[model samples]
Target chain A: MNTLVLTRNDLSVIVQAFGRDALMDEVLAQLRIALREYDPSRTQSLRRQGFVYEKPRLGVLEWMPVMRVSRQVVIKVVAYNPGNPDDVGLPTIVSTISVYDPATGHLVALLDGILLTALRTGAASAVATQILARPGSSIVGIIGCGAQAVTQLHALSRVMQIQEVLFFDTDPSAVASFPRRTAFLGLSMKSAPPNVVARASDVLCTATSVEVGKGPVFEDSDLKPWIHVNAVGSDLPGKIEVPLSLLKRSLVCPDFLEQALIEGESQQLDASEVGPSLSDLVKRQQDFEAYRSRPTVFDSTGYALEDMVATEIVLKHARALGLGRELAIENILADPRNPYGPLDVQASRPAQDRALP
Target chain B: MNTLVLTRNDLSVIVQAFGRDALMDEVLAQLRIALREYDPSRTQSLRRQGFVYEKPRLGVLEWMPVMRVSRQVVIKVVAYNPGNPDDVGLPTIVSTISVYDPATGHLVALLDGILLTALRTGAASAVATQILARPGSSIVGIIGCGAQAVTQLHALSRVMQIQEVLFFDTDPSAVASFPRRTAFLGLSMKSAPPNVVARASDVLCTATSVEVGKGPVFEDSDLKPWIHVNAVGSDLPGKIEVPLSLLKRSLVCPDFLEQALIEGESQQLDASEVGPSLSDLVKRQQDFEAYRSRPTVFDSTGYALEDMVATEIVLKHARALGLGRELAIENILADPRNPYGPLDVQASRPAQDRALP
Candidate 1:
């Protein structure tokens, strides 16, 4: 059997062929179904396992695995190097995702994970915002205008009637380029200070790469009463973007509770203080309608289930468009009992005289 | 940067260029150095994490990750399906190994892991046999003549002056094809019952695919007093190959103590009954020389360190021969700050008019 290999270019073709808005809509709909129907007995997603190193540069390499019982297994191998952009002209994160057949253990497909990760994260936040944000929420605030900010705005635009965007960043160039990068969304964009962005918005997103222990990106005093915040930047132990004081007053729901406590904004609060999980909110949206009148937070640390959903979307599009190469990467041996069968075939040895090096 | 991709065919070319015996010697030498110089502070090899499923078929998919502080990280994703050979004519285990750069998280190379896994397991046992087996041991016994037995006999031939081979398996075809598959080694081969193979041997290797909770592949009374057994097949809970009575009387050294205690022959013995680790034996060979006078067990459940060493050898050979293909699998964006830069380039959009789907 051959494994389908998709490159970054192929993924771009997929996104362009199927309009971005349409793809986001499909992802949002699928994610809602996956979250609403999640059964602990059928789906298994373990916390990521990897190493955090401090030499050569500060970085982490992690493996996130999620298995759908009797169906398939999807795993993403990601590397986060904080110094990649300035030092080596590379993105801060790089990753690859692989899908395997549960019964045969055959690799079905391998896809580039850079764009998939960003898109799925954006969709996850959109799901949260749809359930927790006020129905009339229109003005969106974005802090730390980096790569993630583009998808955050795009995915929210798909779910909400976003009219204007207020954004801020410490880097002048990033603030200047934000409008051009997301001009396709056709929304009014303004570059403002952090406090101004926080206070004049119905919803806010914090996606900064702030140093550990350096933040709660904006103070709680500078926020509106019904603002829904998608806390996207606090993925490391001491790195937080939303203030603990703000989380205490708000109804904080985490994407994955156990993982969020270790690395997300929920790390600031005790387990008892946190609200229901995103899955719970997804299952029972009507039960939490009262939270739309107060402050709310969706703490996302990125889950493997989102990756699995995104992979399904990408592979479906790739298959329809025939946009990847099929390679015989594994040895599907002619004789299953002998691993040396391939070597013997290569040397053209007779069965009785077969020899391995 | 491009990632070098090696398929099964490319790996076959590499093995044919450098003789298998020469390669095993190199692997054995590097493994000894890596084990002797291993320091917990510099190297981190976590226990593997994955899922074990029993629907459609009984199988497991696991990820083994090991890091050499500040240098590199090697990860192996393996799938073990016991029913593959009979149901689909595929090998029982299929896997792929990936190497990542620590500084940039760039995937340096991806290689086929089927043959590499077998070679490394056999070489690990050879390292143990050289340390614990009696020097004049010329007779070798192999229980369960499957794919692993070929490499087991070949690797032992490189380390010992073996004159005869006695092997047995429940499957008659496996027993019939053993000598032809190992024709290169040119050793005397005989097929016998389990007790006979266990009795007339100086060193025994048990690599059976025994069912869970139905083990002790051979009886304790049918063995030599000073024989060293390389227990290779007991990698899951409730699955053991060597009898508990034999393990109680032997000096049992595990390849990795923590992992062995969970899935290897060491699972049958208490923590207090286990001897020093393989790394300990490699570091202080003279201190454990007395083990050669009694029965010893090398509980080999496999480790990531062996895979790391084997990958280094294969890559060195591939580079020297200028083999394998290089593909640009990742998106190294022209503008590091913008994830949509590639899409803009693909669509020929000017920088100011850049838009993502």
Candidate 2:
């Protein structure tokens, strides 16, 4: 059978064709459907939800998350190595996406998930920023300027008009290099300390690689009223970007309650201590005015549904534009009943050349 | 940056170069390591083991099993559609394997898992047969002659000196078509009923796609004394190949107890009723002769470790032979800090055509 292989360059072309606004809108729509369809009760059961494996070694930690979205199935295999960029000059986190036909278990497409992950993650935050951030919010504060920071700014721009950005990073090189890369966005950018960014902005985002059990990125003493916080970095258990005091005091909303309870900033607090989920906000089940009245935190742990949405959109666009090439990766036998048909083709050769024949 | 795509044909060449005995030996060695490394207590944790997702729709049931083995990660996305062969003329079960580098999260290879799966599965049973099957057993009885049956014979041939084969299938077409495939094996063969095969054989293997909750394929009374049975078909929760009476009487050894409790023939009985695991047998922790004196059943449900072993071997062989084509599926930037390097290449295009400038 034919397996369509889409390169990162091919996906970039597709992204260019659709534009970021259209891509963001499509994923935003999928997020709504995903929120509605996601069953928290079925998480442990193998029948509906896919399984995840995390293999941690001395130098590397690998994560494999698999999920089935309607007729399509997706498996993402990723590795996170802290030493990659410094030692190997590779991205700290890299991944691949494989999409399959759920009916016959045939792999339909293979995609580069690194860029897709950044884009989809940015879109998820943008969705929250649209629903939770204050009206006419002009200034945005961003902590941790990495590859994700670029998309975060671009995605937020699709939903809200921002005139300036206050960004900070521990790495001075990353801090110095941000403007030349983001100068194309045409927004006035300020390099600020974490506390200054937290105090001056109407909206804040924390996306750091700070170790768990460490203090929050910014001190809670910097008072900022009605400032919406998108806690993106605190996705692993014990990794908290915002202080527990701030989280406990604010109106907290998680992307997904079950995941946030384990991986997001909300993991710092008890399940009962947190407020409604982002689904509740997206569905208009929460009191928006009341939630916005106090400081609000959107605990954004990356979700599988977002990846499913991104993969689907990418595959759809690639197919429409005839962008990907087919590889002979699946062996579809001429006779469906006989699995050994392929072996027979090679069997005509001499026995000494092959062991099977 | 490069994903080495190994086609089924390329894998076949690698398989030919390596030879089955060498391949089987390497996998058997890996199995020993797997048994030693597998910790059943960590089944639920994301650190050591991955989770599994089972999506069962009205028309299809899809399974996505992800696993991380040391520094190499693998995701097998597969679908099981009963109507595939008849409706679409595709294999009833189709799948793909994606391998990733845990250090950089870069996808290293994409492999056709259909053939690999068959080979690994056969090797698993062969391992069990070597450990549990009676000494000097010459005749092998195989039910449900399909793609797996060929591997069953081939895998067993490596470990035993087979004199004759008794095979049967409910589908007469499969029964009629077996000799052409078996002609390569050059083994004496006979067509017989399930009862006749069971009574005449020293070893038996059942690999049928029989419906769940159906009556057993053969009566408990038909089984020969000290027979070693490889129940390869009953992997689902309710699917069973051998009678419950036979299972109770036999010394049932499962590949993995937790998985076997849910998906193997042992699922028919309680957890307490099942005997030692295949790991226990592979490690020789259980009493061998005493268990072998009774009816011995290898409850083979397949495992993630077997897939890991098969994938590593395939990738190694393919690399050694230079048998795969490289695809630019991952964007590894020249400057590891700049993620927008690729977007700049296509930035000169129009705004309506694309967004990010």
Candidate 3:
């Protein structure tokens, strides 16, 4: 069987074909469908997550998260090697996605997961902003001007009137470069400190690239009431981007409740502190503005549904354009009864050659 | 940057180049190293198993089992579609093996897991037989004669001296065709019922193709004293091939304790009743003849390391011969800082074409 191999360049082309607005619209629609078909009781059977291995005893660990959404089966294998950038000039987070045919257990596509991850995550934050942020939200503050920062602006712009964006990064170079990188969006930008961004924005998005046990970007005193926070970067155990004091006083909505309780910023607080998840929010449309008296947190630990949707988007576009290269990775046996028939043919080749000689 | 895609033809050739004895030897050596590197305390972190998705509401669910052995990470995706054979003429169990480089999170190879699974599983049973069975065992009895049946005999022959063989299957045609298919092995064969085969053999292997909750092939009364039973078929939550009474009477050894407890025949009995795992057996030197008075059951639910080792064997032979094709699936970015540079090129190409027009 043939498997479509979509490289990073291919995905980039696909994402560009459909602009950020259309891509976010497709992702949001897929997320809705994902939530509608999801049975909360089957969550246990739906996904599995674990640390695969640790290199050098105490160094970074590779994590594998596998999940199935309806007919789509996805396994995202990512390595969180802290030393990759310094050692090999590769990104700290490297991932490969395997998409399978659930009916036949055949791998239909192998995707570059690093870019897909960023887009899906940005879209998830956009979804949360659409559902949880107060009406007419305009000004947006973004902390951590890294790879994810551009996507966050691109996605959030599709959902909200992002007329002005404030960028804050500890690295002065990152702060200096954010404006030029995002200049194509035609949105005015200002470089501000963390506290200034926190106090002056209608919505706050934290996508900091911090090590485990890093300091919180801002204290509880800095956050403004009614300003929604998309805590996108704290996705592993011991990784905190938001303070516990702020989370305790806010209506925290997780992307997926179980995952956020473990890997999201809500991991720091008690279970009771976290409110309904994004799935729950999509399932039951609540008057989100009623609970906007305090800061809201969409604890954005990336979900498998978002990845599957983004992958489906890429696969659909690739197949439509006939763009991806076909790899003969899987074998289709002619006869099931003689599974070893191929091996016998190889084993007998030498005898045949010798006989001919 | 390049992943070697090994098709069934490639794997068949590789396995033939290595032969059964060398293949089994390599698998056994890898098993030993796997057990040595395995920390019983870290069992929870080393392996993750879960159902991927279910079709037709409650029908067969695709299962994914992932594990890490040192720097190598492997994920085996198996789809168990009950309606496959009649509906689509496909095997009930369709599997694919994905091997990744943990350090770089790069996929090194994608091997056809269907054949690899059979070979690895058969090798696992053979490894257990070599460790647990009596030294002078000769006669072999196989309960089922399907796809796995051939490999069981092939793997066992490499580890033991089989002067005579007995085959038993409910399907008369399967029983009739076993000898001709395995005629290369040049072993005397006997067609017998399950009870007769159970009572007469020194090594009794139950590789039956039975549905979940089906009747057991044989009971405790049918077992010969000191006969080692390689229970290789039952590997799901509700599936059973061996009688619990027989399991209760035998010293059951699981391939992996936690997995066997969930998917092996041990699922029928309490966790306390299951004896030492095969890893434990491989880790320690045990006196086999001392415990030969009672029946021994090697509960093989299949482990990820076996697949990795078997893949490594295939990969080593394939790489040495340069037999597999490379797929350009992932792109290594020239500048890590400019993650979106590829998209910019795609976006600018259209504008450049427009300017020329």
Candidate DockQ values, in order, are 0.41, 0.44, 0.33
| lDDT of each residue in B83-188, candidate 1, tens digit only | 8877898877788888888788778888877777788888899999999998899999999887788888878887888889999988798899888888767789
Q: Evaluated with TM-score, which candidate comes out highest?
A: 1
Give the runs in model 1 whose Cα sits over 4 Å from its true position: A342-357, B342-357
Question: How well is each residue in B268-336 modelled by candidate 3, as lDDT tens digits?
Answer: 889999988887777774645455667889998777767777777778888998887776555456544
The sequence of per-residue lDDT tens digits that candidate 3 reaches over residues A159-248 is 777778987988786787777667656788998889888887788899876767775887677566788999888656788888888888
Candidate 2 lDDT tens digits, A131-186: 77778888999898777777787677777788889999888977887776665566
Off by over 4 Å in 3: A19-21, A36-48, A52-70, A344-357, B36-48, B52-70, B82-87, B337-339, B345-357
DockQ versus reference, model 1: 0.41
Q: What's the iRMSD of model 3?
A: 6.5
Clashes within 3 Å, all models in order: 0, 12, 0
Q: How close is candidate 2 to the true structure, as a TM-score?
A: 0.88
Q: How does model 1 do on interface RMSD, in angstroms?
A: 5.0
Candidate 3: residue B144 lDDT (0-100): 81
lDDT of 1 by residue, A1-357 (tens): 887888777877887777666677778788889999999789999888678888888788888899999998999888877778778988777878889887877788887777777788889999999999988999999998877788899889877888889999988978988888787677899999888999988999998888888898888886888999999876688889998898999999998898899989999999999999899999999999999989999998889999999999989999999888787776667777676664553333222322323
